[model samples]
Target chain A: MLVQFYNVSKVYPKGKALDDISLKIDRGEFVFLMGPSGAGKSTIIKMMFREEEPTRGQIFIAERSLVRMKRSDVPRVRRGMGIVFQDFKLLERKTVYENVAFAMEVVSAPHREIKARVPEVLRMVGLEDKENSFPGELSGGEQQRVGIARALANQPLLLIADEPTGNLDIDTSLEILDLLIDINRKGTTIIMATHDRELVKAARKRVILLDKGKVAADYAPGEYLVC
Target chain B: MLKNIWYFCREAVKSMARNHLLSLATISTVAICILILGMAVLATLNASHLITRLESDLEIMSYLDKDLTADQASEVKQALEAIPGVESVRFVSREEALQYLQDSFGEDRYNLEETMGKNPLPDGYEIKALDPHQVPVIAQQVEQVAGIERVNYGKEMVNNLFLATKWVRVLSMAFIVLLSLGAIFLIATTIRLAIFSRRKEIYLMKLIGSTDWFVRWPFFIEGILLGTAGSLIAILLLAVGYETLIGSIQSVPFVPVLSNRALLIEVYAGLVMVGALLGVLGTYISLNRFLDV
Candidate 1:
């Protein structure tokens, strides 16, 4: 298994966001987490990214204790995984090419490596023709494609998408889901959190249902249902 | 590190140029302050040189009575030499004194023989002091000597010159202090204004996981460039100003000796350091408040 959550519970001052949650997904597994509002779906992905930590117990990605890692080491943990957010988080002023190239630059990858790798990533996202375009000039779907290109630029072993299609229509949403599936087929482990039951049923992938924090059901090739 | 500094400088220069009014204000403030300080330094140097020159040149003149017997005149000369601060006392014989007057006035056509019914001059001791300020005290003591008719120590003129020198020092020091403060404040505010304007970029850089050094380099480099360029300008102006205005004084030798060339360079060097330091310090201060937020 590449991830393990050992009796982990995350509580905010307001209330418990995650209550004694425990689950493990192995390497190269494509899993979907389906949950209702305030069910800790975002919290789970945040914990996995080391953006937030559980209140008790422990969590590990690649068998490294993310709960115990120093704040400065968060980048190193992130270096191993690619994450996509709902908002795209793209630098609006920068060109599409520079936006994708930024991730490699942060890791101190040599100039030639960035130059060679950026175009390849842009090509994979099918935005090769729009590499010179800015994010403001692109549609939501196209901007999300740039975000995916940025996330996957460093070839992270794991790709986590948090509500990736939360802001898109049914047609555009499925297009994004297909891109995530395509990225998974290329050998990257994928963990996606979403509330789109119709899409989950259509995709037929492994699904974990969270009801009020704990995992209510874990099913292989399952539908997105809490019960 | 070199590459980072170069990149940092390039961005800083570009931004400063884009914000032309701000760069001009910073440079102007630095120049005005430095110009004032440069003038103060030059004036102070001149006044000090003059005081020392006057101190070395002052002498005690002990005039003898024209009716003094030969022995009485000799006694006065010997007594004047014994006074403290008297380095040497030369006896000016009546005939020698008369001949000196003729030589000095010959060109002026002043007939000394017609001015006096007789050779009305008398022998006296022209006494030199180690310092001019001591001339008055020595003159007072010389007044008590027998056979000495009067003393011509030029006390009144010397006292007025000393007072003028003191006033110059007081005024210049005040000017330099005021100007330095003006420069510090100007540079600090210039940097603050610049940093305040681009605070959005800084916030984004921080959230993007850029380290403190990565964020600080641009502001640090901007300060240095402003200081260097402004000071360099001041130095060039000072160099030209000195050559045009002060060069004549140097050749005249009668003008108090001042190290014009050196002070001009010091003004530039001082401004450069001061300007840069103020820029960096001001940026650091502003960043502390802004970054912590």
Candidate 2:
């Protein structure tokens, strides 16, 4: 398994965010976490990135339990994964090229590698002409595309995107989905969380529906019930 | 490591430039506080020097009655020499006293002789005391001698000088500590504002797997630069002001001041180090609070 949550649970002071959740994702799989706003899909994604720890149970990424890892080791684990959010958190003052290059720089990537890889990622995201443009100058969808490019800058084996299309129009959403699909076809495992039933239907991927902090249902590709 | 340092320096310089007004405010506040602290240090050092000189020179002067015969004056001197803590007593004749005054007046002796034909200076015994703390007691004993006119021991003046020196020491220490705290708080707030302005960048950096130190290096450099800059300005100002004061003080002839080159260098180095230290402290405080991720 590439990622595993063995009976993981997370409880905030307010309530239980994820209760008794167990699941497994294999390598190169494209999985959808379909749920409403309070279904704890984001929490599950956060646990995978080690942003939040399971209150009770073990979470393993590539067979190493995240709960037992030291704080200093969290970054090493995150380097093998890429994360995207609904807000498309880009540094507004930085150019698109800088936004992607910054991700590599944080990991102390070699100057030659950064210089060579940033342009390639920009081209992959179809933002080659806009590399020099600041995020404020781009459309919402283009900004999210830059977000994806930045996430992929490290060329991780796994990608976790939380509502990647939540802030986009339907046409832009499909484009972003197509881009994700293409990246998945190139062999990166993807776990995307969203509430859009129609989008999930259109993608025809394996779906995990969460309700009230539990996995309500699981469906194979092209067989999900619209919830 | 060298590349990271270059990047940190570049980023620090850019951030400082971006918030030029706040940076200027922080720097000026630090400079002014350090300048006051330097002045206090100089004052405390000079005052202690003056006190040491005064304490070492403690003496009791007992004037002799003009009508006393030579034998009576000799008897009075012998009695004074017998007093506890009296090291020695030297008798000055009327003529010798006048001559001593003339010597002390230097080039103005001729003018003093022209102004007054008769010798008006008093003949007295200069008594050196073994202990400065006992000068007042020995003076009281000498005043009781039969042929002595009056006693002058500078007791009140010495007591006041000691009191003033004590206060100066206390006040200078308090000022240094208070000013350092104020500088730290101001620098910390300014750095905090800078971090807040770039919070998005920091958050993104954290998400991309940068270690806490990697994210903090640029801000730490920014703080160090501000601290050093502020202290350097204060040191330059103090040097100019102190050198001018020294020039003017030379005309006053006898006011003790700290003019040793080594001591001045020590003060300068101390101020610069303090500035840099406070900068690091302030940066540490702000970063710890905002960079928990």
Most TM-score-accurate candidate: 2
Candidate 1 residue-wise lDDT, B1-293, digit = tens:
65556666766887798778998887776666666666666667667777777767777778887788888777777787777778898988877888898898875587687778577777888888877777788889999998888889787887887788788778878877777766776778887888787776564344334455666777888877777677667667766876777667667766766665676566557766866776676567666555531
- Look at candidate 1 and give me any clashing residue pairs: none
True contacts kept of each: 0.00, 0.59
lDDT of 2 at B240: 95
lDDT of each: 0.79, 0.88
Clashing residue pairs in candidate 2 are none
Candidate 1's residue-wise lDDT over A28-145, tens digit each? 8999999898898999998887668889989988989988777566666777887787888887667999888876655555678889999999999899999899999999999999
In every candidate, how many clashes are there? 0, 0
TM-score of chain A of each: 0.96, 0.98
Q: How do the residues A1-227 of candidate 2 rate in per-residue lDDT, one tens digit apiece? A: 99999999999999999999999999999999988899999899988988788899999999888997898888888899988889999987789999899899888898999999999988888999998999999999999999999999999989999999999999999999999999999999999999888789889999999999999998988888554
- Point out the worst 10-residue segment of candidate 2 chain B by lDDT: B106-115
Q: What is the TM-score of candidate 1?
A: 0.61
lDDT of 2 by residue, B105-181 (tens): 88663756667977877678999988777787888898898888889978789788767778878887888788789
